[model samples]
Target: MAGVDPDDCCRGAHAAAQRGEFTQATVWDACRTGIRDAIESQLDDEQASPVIIDGLPTIGKTQHATDIAFGLDVPAAILTHRYETRDEHLNLAAEHQKTVAEIPTLDRDCPTRRGDHGSGWAERINDYRSRGASPTYLHYYLQDALPCMQDGDCPYLARWDAVEGADVVIGGPAHAALDRVVDDRVVIFDEDPGTAFRTEFDANQLSTAISTFLRRNDDLPVDNHFGLIGAATNESMDAIRDAIRDELSDNISIASPREAVDDDDGHAEAPTAVLAMLELGGPIIGDTAPAEYDWDDQLREEAGLDYVELPDGSQVVYDHAESRIIIRRPPDLTDSRAVVGLDGTPVEELWRGRLGVDDIESWRILCDDCRARYLRDVIGYTFVQTTSHVKPYSSGEYVNRRADFGLIEAVENRHETAPGVITTKSAAERLFEESPSEPFIDIQRVTNRIADVKHYGALRSSNDFTGTEVGIVLGSPHPGDRPLQITAALEGYTAVRDDEGKGTDLDYGIPDRPFLRHYREHKIAQAVLRFGRTTAATVYIHTGVLPEWLAEMVTAGPETVMIDERSEGQRGVIRALLDEAPGTAAEIAKRERVSIGEKQTRDWLKRLRSEGYVSRDDSQPYTWAADGLADAPHTARVRLPDLE
Candidate 1:
């Protein structure tokens, strides 16, 4: 097993390919030796430790893990962070001739769907939840009543039985944690399961649940001093806990109001905070602070609680303007069970110190030279950098304007293949909302070539945009200072706050380069890499926040031309014509097949020439070409007309 050869895997894969079987031989051939050696080294150690295989994207990490879990010949579980990746693993495991079972969460399922929770379950739940319907009853129906008393079979629970019988199990991190499936078996985490460990509950949720519990459990001897806001003592928290425990024990079912319209704008959901509070054995208070978390003194005081020592070594903190309490604890991987993690960007301190994994080892399948060779020879990757303002909270007018200019430049330089656009969900939504507006409409030609558009959160472990040669990343996804401070605290880094006593609007507190890179630069990199580095692909990064490693590969792209006082329709036609090959105004207009007349196009071209957006040839049949001025543009704000 220690000598598990890449050549052997390649031979098997080649045989499979000849037989028309599913095979990713190229990836297995590249990194299987490193993976095997890493596993072998870990196996020799007397004490069990988590082994993380750090490899670049599209290197078959998931597939290799699936194969290793299958070879272990035990009831194994593969945990994934994203739904797309989880689904991908399920399919990948099945293809590898492994009996796999999937456990799906009931978060998106309809509560009243007695049977298998058929299609449209998500829509049904969302529709009701959106219309201000109480989710407390829905939780009761789905969790308690339906599973225990319903006539039809419950797919969610039924899958567990299948999981017990299967050789391999595939599911999300949350499911694995809840089911205790990580114990006594080989568990492979496909990505960082931070979301599973980070428990968050808003103050409004606790307040609503407290009010609901008191009103419903009037018979119980519960005190009314459990106020979540303002200065509160431990005694008040105990009263809140007692009330919640009673409510849970009674198992009283509440009917969801069909037409309940509360103007509070809060979901009338279950007593999630109440239940979690009870689970934490009270109001998230403990005697000793945990060593794994760096609790901000001010933040803890604001939340009315600090990092409390628990039996499981978990810690709690408060964050965001919403006043949410967050509890973080690493998933238990004890009892000498083999634990392997798969991640491209492994934050060692985050895993070891913060997540409470004391003894852990990491192995990179591809070194710098190896990865560079892969990128150069196999990927043929080209990087294009831009200076656009892609931050979500930045000025809408400026961000949109810069984004349009950058995208237009990238599109002009791109090959014939369709492009992929990656941005924040808000920016993606704004594309549609402001399609008729100036800057957005100006990038219509670029938008039309977009084969796909994905947000930051959904970019990881996705293959949807692999075929796209050109990828345009709008911005870097920054988690802000509060999260950065929490991460810094967890990873044993000093969080330097400003003299204003404010963590908000501060960027330089956490000096740890890796944490900063992980939270900021890695997001943009992940989005760009989704287009896959295998084969020739040109990536256009629109923001300044990029990693040094990625920045080294940056090449010059076309200049973003800025035009002032240009109408939407006329500007769109001019930009479209500019992006096209060199031709006369009529020729370019005909090539675009736009409704704008040739004369109108020429007039707009002349205006753009005066505005330094384009340059006209001195020939009889004048050729209009974009100037591609990469400098500051005219700042005159003017209202533009809509496209006809």
Candidate 2:
């Protein structure tokens, strides 16, 4: 068994362990043993089992994966969620004296038939693809119509060749195209694979795919395979799901021609429609029978399906309202030597239910005391949330109405300097539009700016807000009620609709809370990590849900502090008395005639202070002063008679 030495851990984890914070240390030790055991146990078996490292965020899971990739004697592949993350790990590998190649994905700048890059080429190619042009058609079209790809000296192909024998290969979730490139090699998923495995397509795209198939095989008997889909789009959700499943079963025999071995890498060519059909809801079988005729002029064959695996645990459901079909299945990892997944919040049911993974080993920090001590003593964080349930929809209303209910003001008051705001991009835009002046950093112009605003989805794999001393999470990034219920239903959990039709009760009679909590709280934790977990920072959450791990570290429980709605005349009178001389609330109230007692005056002062209009000191009398006007002359104080 391999052991993880305290000093061998990442800097943050090492420091935390040295400070007697056992969460990271305990997790690191478990990961070291568990990962090795899982790998070794699989080496002797014909098929390798997956290993998931579910350590807390910033607990060096990525660092550990990097070491494993570089240290392994066999070839390895690392798949990240984004291109930026791949580059980050590439740099991390450099620190360990390992050089790796990044397999780039296609974008607008990729070469087309004309060999031109950017807007013109992108627009032309997009227009062509929008008409249902297959990648094979586009490849042949570019070859005959242009001068660049005729010789087949493509930069994209050359990148794959460059990383041919390298010990490590880094890229994004598009690794399905790699096929045998990662076969029988250890593959590491740097984050949750849920987003990578899930596929979402609207009705229009599905119709276009069916039309593309009809254009090629007009006389074929495959019309029934897609004919019901159009009618299903108008039906109920259950009907839509059943219709698609029936079509998938009907199209099971509609196989492509014998696969042709391409010279570039022996990859089989399947028709565009066939690819789309299988992607929609295909069975997990490996091979299909040869078709009677090939669609394209180029010889095509039924390639052994090595891309997607829709086993017993896969889910296929139709979103009727959106006219969309969502499929959640695991990627085909039949030939991978071993698989390792790293995620901060690893929901095992999600892995089994949504991702369709069955044989997997997980390592996590199970001790509550260890985790709480690590967060409170080692990370040094202060967690606070609003008493009110700031639902996802309410966030937009709060910003649009300019009524944050003192949530924003209280967060601002907690920090001495400006704090970052993490909410929906719509709410952030509204905040920008309603602000009195330009923000210190423009959220639109430069993403790497020291801005005070960061939307929820944009905070992944970013450290730009590390300098931000505080973070005010405005609301939970809940993916609405319907989506949550759909996910819960897909996970085999029953969802009960409300009588009013306003919401759903996914948790009704369920042994535990539904996937809604996991989905929402995972996003909240991701948002909080933007403050740089290694550094000491405070986070004020206005969201209704708080993850159990974070809830343990809450120094200030949820409580509402409404800003006093006193008239400007009464507020000005208190400001006048404070500016004249810093005095106790009772002494100041004695001088002013606001028809309020000392206690009421004190409450009003606290409200004003929270709004940055007044300051109070920790003394026997608790003296109050108009902030920044304590030294002002008598002329600065507005008399009660002068109030408008």
Candidates in order, TM-scores: namely 0.68, 0.69
Model 2 residue 168 CA deviation in Å: 0.6
In model 2, which regions exceed 4 Å deviation? 1-38, 44-48, 96-99, 108-118, 126-141, 146-152, 222-315, 353-356, 393-395, 398-410, 434-451, 489-510, 560-644
Model 1: lDDT to the true structure: 0.56
RMSD of each: 9.5, 11.2
Model 2 clash pairs are 257-301, 257-302, 258-301, 259-301
Residue runs of model 1 more than 4 Å from their true location after superposition = 1-30, 37-46, 95-98, 104-152, 210-222, 225-305, 312-314, 320-322, 352-356, 388-398, 402-406, 409-414, 435-440, 486-507, 557-644
Candidate 1: lDDT of 606?
77
Global lDDT of model 2: 0.54
